[model samples]
Target: MNYITCSQGHKSTGGSNFCSTCGEPLQNSNHYLEPTLIGIQPGTRLRDRYIVREMLGQGGFGRTYIAEDTGRFNEKVAIKEFIPSVQGTGALNKAVELFQREAVTLYQLQHSQIPRFWEAFQENSRLFLVEDFIEGRTYESLLNERLRQGRCFSEPEITKLFQDLLPVLSYLHNQGVIHRDISPDNIILSGKTGLPILIDMGAVKQVTVNVATNLQTTSAPRGTSIGKVGYAPDEQIRLGIVAPNSDLYALAVTAIVLMTGKQPEQLLDQYTLTWKWDREINLSLLMTQVLNRMLAPRGDQRFQSADEILSFLGLRQTNPAYSTPNYSGNSTPIYQNPAYSTPNYSGNSAPIYQNPVYPTPNYSGNSAPSPVNNSGCGQIFDASIPVPQEIKGWNWGAFLFGAFWSVGNKVWIGLLCFIPYVGLIMAIILGIKGNEWAWKSRRWASIEAFKANQKTWAVVSLCLTGFVFVIVFLASLGGS
Candidate 1:
């Protein structure tokens, strides 16, 4: 999956002509090209069937690309190149075997949302998997577009989001599959069907993480987080343990972000370990209960399966209230509900869901480039020295305070805000790149320390923004 930065410094998935965040036209130069990491060049032929078109994106796991399959009349497909970080040819060959074996299960999975796995092959000492190419923007982009319009996702759309995606989850889970990484970036709104299609990474990310952990330098942190920092559950993050509910927990996090136009760090209370989003938006009591249960800190406390959630959504014919969904003429995509063909599962309760769709290495090459240095948001991020994914997202403090926020974070590049017109662009850049730049430039004791510093700035920025808004409103009223 490739990524391009828009005028607002928003990093959007590749293959999109417009900015997913700001909806601005993207220049070709803005399409991030890795100044390094030559995995495969364009026009390369593989298996005498698939021809490489261009590299889409890369990550700590591997790189993903778009290719033309000659066997299928040159239909475009996604190709993931897995280069394990481990040393030794014996280990590499064994890893390839595990990868091919895991690909078999993915081949068995047939669903409307999951991209079809074509085949896995090894050529020239490199491993590759061919998959269906989904043409559309990610849910992250869709939500960003909504935010650009001065609003967030409506309750109606979010309800339908669950309605549309839950079945896909049920299908995968019933097949004994668990999607450990589920976030808005991994779920794409298909251009063909307008349905949220899940593009899976399956064992690909597992292979990447396992290999790196064994080969990592002493400076590396203990234990690895497979899912995004905020979206993934605690067990998955702390213990590398995963279950069906892990995916559900992430789905709730995605919903909260889209529903309130706020990220996890902003919504969660570190001290109280509680969500503070009730005042942000008004949701039905039932919906709130579902989210809270799914977001339960402990895995055992949350719903265990997808069907349980479907049933709890008032899916029973006896309950017409939850049966008839509310439509508010909003542009959010709502699909035809799946028939209530319940699957055989033991536990019964409402569970949330999640999977990935970043444009760089999206299990099928679907995430943004993980920055390795003070890399510009528009530039290709290095995979070798990966940056922490936690700090990635909009920084309200950086956006509001402009150059002042830069001075505090020690991201001196942001000080260009002193210039008149450049100040506006600098502010946008700071908001997007501030956290990452600060992480790289300054010496923080830990990720927590770094986030703590920014969170305080974020609170202050919010208050200042609100104060300025009030003053402007009062002045307008007096003039009127």
Candidate 2:
């Protein structure tokens, strides 16, 4: 088989970087040759195994084909062809190196969310890499289809997409691999399950070397940006700095576009201001907040890692009900247990070395430990409620109210003992940490806090009852 000449009319002087006639870099022009079967062949095969069927797609650097491997019982595989320039002494060698690199990169990745690479070989002066054929539409197709149908996806649906890809992105980042190009076109949706499989690793960068990382972070060469312009993060475009968080930013944009059925460009133009869309989707506040954080204009403003976004969404955190309070936002829950206060560890007393001081403590003891005595002040709670880490970020105003109530209970403890039912009610109110104090264990704490006030409450109740009886008797005599 003869190597095809480029459009420059220069025949590929086998394995050269530039053409001998025009001095311009020459590529194999016969890349459009479809793969033929073993039984029906016009020419002898390169390895006598793969029979080219037809060209699937082509890019600036390579082309993909749907081919049948005769040696493997005629199984189908997608083959990528890399055309080496006919100029430099080792032009073909460099092209083969890149082909091998792509094969190796794909082989190392074994996640269910990524496509699998099969084999690589050089045929008829052209380098080709074979991979498993995914019979699915790209995410770009799905978005267009939804838009044509005048429909949009819900937040839950979008969350399922992110949840599947989050772990994959984390894996790539941990391995120091960055998919510099992350966009709808690069994402393939499984036609059978509607799940996504990330494809195209030619643009992936391995930043294991410090020199490569520094160079990429400083200046990105022209024509290197393969990601959709709107979906690509600014840092990735301006600087070749591709990080795990950058992929997350693109995913967030993808989610927004999928949920609203809007084009990425339109969304980017309107991103600076508030957006009102025609679609209706039931999205949780937590999901929306995480998405916005991921799509923040600056990379620093976005989540530091994929795990951070997952934590904010309450997905990666082990506790199903453990919710973090909003320190910088207004939607935080207001927990009020009037009978208890968070202990002041910042005071002159040496701080208690609780393992998870602000977070939920791991209780390994036989029983729940008693509250520490800070003279007379201590945190009180109902024995039943589980305390979480978010409680540490609670408002101190509630704690102040509990402190005053505790003092009042100590001074008037005896008053609560005299009035029978009234005295009992007062004691219970003072002892139990109710909604007013944000105490999780309000019942137990309330009983202990107001023990001294019970007697005072009882005497006051008895006096009020006697006075009411005397008044009633006098009124009856006057009427007679």
Candidate 3:
């Protein structure tokens, strides 16, 4: 198949005359292709498996592409082409080694919101990292769409986003992974699940920068570093230092940008290192207080961990009956937990290092460790109120939708589906525990209302599952 990346980053596959995604001309005298990195071209095969489809986007970090993996039954993937802005063959080799090292760590991450990191390889004197391709618009794209409609994300929408995403962040931080980059462009809203999926690990970018700086002969290129100008914190940008809070700073900037439809430069005061975002728009005092602390110029002043942010937002799962402060975003929430105080991470400059090992695809009786510590869940359920026997059954919706369903219903355990190897087992567990978890977590009008909602979800999920099976059947017949 001949492929060419059109000006709009759309690929013309299947010998088409026009681009498949945007209807752009494949070979027109009038229009030219979008400016892409030199060397890597469309239709280029790498590692005898991945067929490059189009250059999705390029950045200071690296060039990203939409590719098809023939080995994975033609599954689409996002491949990052690591182009070190450095000189010398020795330096390039060092960079590749660094890239692989960081890639290994990224590959270990298994969170529902994070795209699965697949493989890291050196091909054609270039380094590439493969990841699951998300079929959705970036938050940046979504924000632009909203701006076009003469509005931006509302306070409540942004609040819900914070609620949805903070747990994912807590999961990453606990796993000793720092995204480094947490801007709107990096957060994609998955079309299939309608959940925000975090993409692009800046650890790769940081590795390139470290190689360039440490290796005396190999001078690092300006753009090869982790910090984005406005999104990055003072310590990250001015000094080469980062912590879990650094990501929180970027996330705050992203929220404000999405809410105000303004750039960080517009919101922040250059001299005082204070944000004037409130001048532009008025938000609830609680939200105002939260964003201010997150956007604080000093790293120590910001929320130390993503768990802290989740705590502040009252999103953590906790026992409702206990007068000892439980997790409830509604019904007079608890702002802080007595156990969770601001962590003093004064000495820790980078992600906490864990013993890295190759993942063996085996399931022990013990389930894969979840990213976020939601142990409070066990205590959340009341002993007196027994689960209704009438509605207790395997949940088709939970089984089918996985984390997508779990997230909506506040069943944190269902997110185990995002775990590296134990996801299938977790899906079955979700089906079994779905009804009980939902009953405890949320406040429904009545048991009837709860049953009705679950029933509706099951119906929709079954219909969608059937539709997918039919598509696969037709495709298999066509191939045969």
Tell me how far the alpha carbon of residue 405 in candidate 1 is from the true structure, in angstroms, after superposition.
37
Error of 3 at 217 (Å): 11
Ranking by TM-score: 3, 1, 2
TM-score, candidate number 1: 0.57
Query: Taking the tens digit of each residue's C-alpha lDDT, what string does model 3 give over 1-480?
Result: 445554333445544667677786555332223223474677877777888899988877678899999999999999988766664456666776667667667766777788998998864346789999999999999999989999999999888788778777766665556677899999999999887888887777765665556554343322223768899887667644556677899999999999999999988878656676766777764676578678765655566766667777777622122112122232211111101112222333322232112111222223432222111123234554456676689999999988888888877878889987798998888788788788665544346777888998899999999999999999999999
Best by TM-score: 3
**Candidate 3 residue-wise lDDT at 54:** 95
The true-versus-predicted C-alpha distance at residue 295 of model 2, in Å, is 1.3
Cα lDDT listed for each candidate: 0.67, 0.51, 0.68
User: What tens digits encode model 2's per-residue C-alpha lDDT throughout 122-172?
Assistant: 643456677777789887887888878887767777777777667667655
Error of 3 at 212 (Å): 3.7
Q: How does residue 37 of candidate 3 score in lDDT?
A: 48
